[model samples]
Target: MQVVLRKLGRGSRAVVGRLVRAPRKGSVIVIEFSDGMHEYVTTPVKRVLRLAGREVFYIETVNSRYRLEVRGREVALDGAVGG
Candidate 1:
């Protein structure tokens, strides 16, 4: 799924890419950039919060917080509705 990832802090910019790995507790989140390079959240994920009935997500990792918006298609991550 296509997604836009933004770190929640000052000076942060949105990073658009394809979702390679969905955020899960105890795992790293990964995104594949358009340039074919992959961006990985080196810190282990602490939690994943999804808005009810929406494709938006809030991910809290060891050292950073992120907002992820899934675009184009519905993604059913583990623990989400219909997953």
Candidate 2:
């Protein structure tokens, strides 16, 4: 699935890519960046929050927070876990 990942902090930029691994509790979230380099959020995921009736996701990790937006209609975020 195609996704845009942005770290929630000062001077953060969004990274567009394909989702190589889905987010699960205590697991790493992986994305194959548009530049062809794989980006990994190595900290075990703490939480995932989904906005009601939206495809956007907020993820909290051990050391940082992130905003992940699912792009395109070809993919459905059925595996996402939300709080």
Candidate 3:
């Protein structure tokens, strides 16, 4: 499949990375981009292994912080950033 890249940072719409797999508490997801930049995001379930992958983009507002899930076209985020 063809992949697209974009700028990502602290904002409403940030296409950070693609989901490597299911994330649990303390788990990490290796988000890769077409530009060859990558980041290791922790998962709640367990540790994560970094890897290369595709990307995404959109505008989102979450209710909470500790809970973040992506089911199809929807990205679910719960809890607060620092509360």
Q: Top model by lDDT, which number? A: 2
Candidate 1 — which pairs collide?
Answer: none
lDDT-superior candidate, 1 or 2: 2
- Please write out the lDDT profile of model 2 over residues 33-83, one tens digit for every residue: 777766755487889888789888899988889998989545566676855
Model 3: lDDT to the true structure: 0.32
Write down the lDDT of every candidate, Cα atoms only: 0.78, 0.80, 0.32
Off by over 4 Å in 1: 40-42, 78-83
The true-versus-predicted C-alpha distance at residue 5 of model 1, in Å, is 0.5
Query: Which parts of model 2 have CA positions greater than 4 angstroms off?
Result: 35-37, 73-75
The TM-scores, one per candidate, come to 0.83, 0.82, 0.30
Alpha carbon lDDT of residue 16, candidate 1?
Answer: 87
Best by TM-score: 1
| Clashes (candidate 2) | 0
Give per-residue lDDT, candidate 3, residue 64: 18
lDDT per residue for candidate 3 within 26-55, as digits (tens), equals: 444344444656653432333222222312
Model 1 over residues 3-83: C-alpha lDDT tens digits?
Answer: 898999999988888887667788777888888866744487887888887888888889999998988555657563221
- When summed lDDT is taken over every stretch of 10 residues in candidate 2, the lowest stretch is 73-82
